[model samples]
Target: MSRFPLFAMAVLGLGLVFLYVPTLLVIATSFNESRLAGVWTGFSLRWYGELLNDRQFLNATANSLIVAGLSATAATALGTCAGLVLARHGRFRGRVLFLGLLATPLVLPEVIIGLSMLLVFVAAEQTLGWPAGRGIGTIVVAHATLAMTYIAYIVQARLTGLSRECEEAASDLGASPLRVLTAITLPMIAPAMGAGWLLAFVLSLDDLVIASFTSGPQSTTLPMVIFSAVRLGVSPKINALASVLVVMSAVCLGLAAWLQARRGGKVLPE
Candidate 1:
């Protein structure tokens, strides 16, 4: 029994190392002076400097930020509403089927989602003569479709843990449902919403497959740029860019964690 416990711990440790050690190595190599990724010739920030000055990279970053922010906000709003209806109002006619449809994107292959969205855009352009062509709008819609599922899941979980007493109290005090929701309910679930927003943001920003299928030349996101660059060959610049992204993600996620902790250990409010 003791040997089995030791083996389990060993396996867990190995798993962690396998997952993270390479990432740490890549981060360390980003600072390496040598162009060859395998070699380290002292530490230098030259690659980082180069990345900062690269206009294409900067433009892609800006585009990514805009897309992530807009898509996440839209997704969070839609998901929050859906979650409220599902959790608080309970099951209604066709609700289960609707929820299953909503959740389909979460499990369906991303490539399929991307292709479907692309086909729809093409069809719309051909038939309705709208959208003009695919670009930022298309990407945003695709991202929002996927990201909303995450937000809905988070908000639904939050709603499940919430106490209805607060809203009841507000109603007893002559506050309307809208007023209670705008004031008490919104505040109570704000943490979960914030977390869901951040999660959506990350998902949108990191997405490559869906973006590739849906995006136009003018709307190429950071991941798309990275993918294109990598297709040519490995470059230290790519590593540098990846390190920057990893750092940004870490900082954003850390901030979200701190805020969540400060609000209370619970992901949802009561």
Candidate 2:
């Protein structure tokens, strides 16, 4: 019986290795001195240095960061408001329709979403003469649209699980609804909001399909640039860029985890 359990553990360990070994290989290959991505000649930081000097890469990075930051902020605000309405408003009319509309992007194919947004932008530019062209603004709007649904879902789940007694108590103590929301509710759900914001940021940063459709020629993102580079040939500089992004993603995730742990505190339930 113990032997069987040990065998199962071995299989599980092998599964983990299969999943993560490729990722580790990518990280290791990023330091290769050779221009070839797969063939490692020796460990070197030259690729990283070259990546820093690439103007196109730098421009793409700046564009990605700006879109991610702006879209995440807008999405978080919209999603939090939507989540609060869903959680607090009891049996409002058209709630089902509202929820379905909000969740459409989550279930819809990315290709469909990108195409639809692109068409809409084209239509608007032709008819209304507004947003005369597609660029960063278009990309930001597209990203924010996708991100809002995820944030709303996260926040709604968090709000549903949280205790309502605290809000009720605040209400009893002559606290206005807005006051209670700003002080008690927001503080308690801060962790969820932070998580949602980070998630939105990552989604926007990583998006290629939607950004490709929505962005103009001059506003190409990092992923688009990398994809173009990969089409030409695999370069160690690309790997180095990817390694930097991986580190950034890990740091963001770690920070979110820390915030969650701190908010929950060190106490264990008896």
| Predicted structure with the largest TM-score when compared to the true one | 1
lDDT of 2 by residue, 1-270 (tens): 899999999999999999989777778999888877657699899988998889999999999999999999999998898878877788988999998989887889989999999999999999999677999999999999898887777677778778899999999999999999998999888887888788788888889899999999889999999899989987778888888877877777677667656656211111
Model 2: lowest-lDDT 10 consecutive positions: 261-270
Give the lDDT of residue 62 in candidate 1: 93
lDDT of 1 by residue, 138-163 (tens): 89888998988877877887777778
lDDT score, candidate 1: 0.87
Candidate 1 pairs with clashing backbones:
none
**TM-score against native, each model:** 0.94, 0.90
Location of the lowest summed lDDT over 10 successive residues in candidate 1 = 261-270
Model 2: CA > 4 A from native: 1-8, 264-270
